[model samples]
Target: MVREKFTHIYARAADRKGGEAELESLLATPLSAQELKGISDDRWLSAFTQKVFQSGMSWKVVRNKWPNFEEVFFGFDIEKMLLMPTEMWERKATDPAIIRHLGKVMTIPENARMIHDAALDHCSFSAMVADWPAEDITGLWRYLKAHGKRLGGNTGPYTLRIMGKDTFILSHDVEAYLRNIGVIDGGRDTRKSLQATQQAFSEWQQESGRPLCQISQIIAFSQGDNRL
Candidate 1:
């Protein structure tokens, strides 16, 4: 049933009339944040390292200093990071070129270790995601706790949504981003947001549903790279 709803949304969003062109536009022009997240394996380490640098700093500052972070962090190579000597850690802790928060600066190694552990247990860092179920947002929160996610807050769940790990309806950013694209209003609170998402899903199920493959084709038509 949930899959049906997802299929429907993809179909409608991927409608062809304006979808293809809009998708082309988005594919042609990349947003900075989007580009950062989309980094390939060759640069994934660099991107993740950049994410750590921004942990306690404003995203804006992190954005501006991304190049420097990449350079100093050795392009995000996990092995290199894991093997970083104590002296190098000290240097980074005081480096004005990076975010200089003492605690965050120091915890980089520990955080990397946690990520490595998660990868070992789950086959990939992405395996950590199975900690949460997709159908229930609240359950997802509970799952995070059980799976050893230290940061637990409303914002944590929202972060999961933003990171595309969970597709719960409490996605404030998705709601707001969709609103910006004129799909839904931004003023809706969490309850209303979930309701809207539920209704949309319900509606899609009632219509003839498409599979992930065919749905991809329709999204190619309707959603058109608007990233909706």
Candidate 2:
């Protein structure tokens, strides 16, 4: 009886539609490593990379200023960054091309030193990527937050999870949809709600002989109504 009830609820929740759009709307536009490498000097890349990290603001603003940031920060070259003194930080802080946050401006050099040290120890950022752990969500979480990454705390974890990179199972949207379908108790604790969904999803996958990817398709199809 409970099985029939859950299957019906799942069918209803899955009918919402436009899951892809919902996924697209939530992603942040961060630059890839390959794009970051095009700059002439690593110093500019270093400074700009850190600048983007400091960008708690809109990604579009950061994306637009990427070239300017490279120009202003000596192409993020680590040596140049290490050479920079307090005067250089003050100069960049006043520049309109970059974020201009004093704290972020100052963090560039320090971050450069850290990156440099890491490079020496780990053989550049590329090497670390090459040696990355499992593609499973939990492994991705450990990798991202590994080695003092400080990945923006909970929101960062949530973002990575939604993008299918890390330990999180249920997304905020999925949880909301579950509530909309009246599967788990809406007023219950979130942890409990999430656990219940995970269990139900697991069982459904087993019974339906569907992988998570196929399940994602079902989610997208069912939730089509969630478009912008």
Candidate 3:
């Protein structure tokens, strides 16, 4: 039997998705803080670059060429990436080995610089991210957007989650659910809307003790015509 209280969101999602077990299986777990802190800086830079390239492109295509990207980028070594000359970048752009978008290729150096700077300041970039409170994940989003190139919108959130940070992406379904429930209004990226969405998620977390990732997923599953 489902309780009809604050946890109705969980109940509704479970009901629509077959049962609680099914819903649990559908949710992805975020990496723990200590595990996240253990990830190397180069891997972080590599993941960020991958997501940037995949943003508006075919994920399959990008994935197929990822090995070349690693080779060309010198395994995403922070110091080596910083030392890569502008002319080398141009040559790499012309290489058939990887996706040759100059603008996107150019973004890598800037993001690497940002990550390297964080590493210098906080002992390691992963440490800084691991230390950040999940309750204000949006602050981390804003900081990354202001500091890193091409990291605004879903890019930063997506990369953070991929790197094991416990954050949420405002996927279309999640945005639609937020709006339909009046937790948000107008543009999903607006400050007012994000604040409202954050508050709602925080309240839900308090009640259910679920990670923000799962809560975000549940909110999306509980709404629209997703019943199955």
Candidate 4:
């Protein structure tokens, strides 16, 4: 099966979304490396923690309760988070002030430690993530999965995206497009499938001169019934 070129994809998305300008308006741009580097490690930890809690749950629910999460986690400061004792974690898990899932709540300290360690190695977690090669973003995803708690699958990808890292998310629509284009063959999460996705997106990025995020969104908008 032949794969669709970026031009064909973009045209379909544009037609569905009310032309080029409308499609562009719907697309989100990723941050520059310098911009990503300037963000604090605390923000990185907080963003990933938010994604962890939002996983398999209502994102709006998490958003509504975020201020409380910030307060309970002490603004997600790496040092302060690392200092939290096991007893404190247990207590906080049951606290009505935030989501009470012990498993998700526990991602805080371990992810904090991961970010803290990254900071020591790269001056800041922000610096490391921002510096990661977008061309091989799956590598960073793997790194996060190996190093951080509850950060595998789309969790890591979502956090990187929230932090403005230039990465693509394998969303339902995006995955569907990939399968339609023969870019993905079998199980969606398999290493082979992921690498195929990366390669396809890289080609599209080169062809369209668009960031992976934009290209990913364009593909999603092109394929799904989510039209205007």
Instruction: Compute the lDDT of residue 66 as modeled in candidate 1.
Output: 75
Q: 1-228, model 4: which lDDT tens digit per residue?
A: 237778988899999999999998998889999999899999988899899989889999999999999999899989999998999999999999999999999889999999999999999999999889878999899899999999998999988887789899999999887887788879987889878888888888888899988988888898878898
Please write out the lDDT profile of model 3 over residues 51-158, one tens digit for every residue: 999999999999999999999889999999899899998888879899989999998899999999999988989999999998888889888899999999999999
Candidate 2 structure quality by residue, lDDT tens digits, 1-228:
113343453464444433445543433343344543332335423533543454477867777777887788777778888898898789888898777777666666765665566568656643433244323323433444453233333433443332332132344555455666665676433445545655655655556554443443345344545433
TM-score of each: 0.47, 0.51, 0.94, 0.96
Candidate 2 segments exceeding 4 Å error: 1-56, 135-150, 154-171, 174-225
Which of candidates 2 and 3 is the stronger one according to lDDT? 3
Error of 2 at 110 (Å): 3.3
Q: Which numbered prediction scores highest in lDDT against the true structure?
A: 4
lDDT of 1 by residue, 112-134 (tens): 56556666776544445534333
Cα displacement (angstroms), candidate 2, residue 228, comes to 7.8
lDDT for each candidate structure: 0.48, 0.51, 0.87, 0.89
lDDT-best of 1 and 3: 3
What TM-score does prediction 2 earn? 0.51
| Residue-pair clashes, model 3 | 0
Candidate achieving the largest TM-score: 4
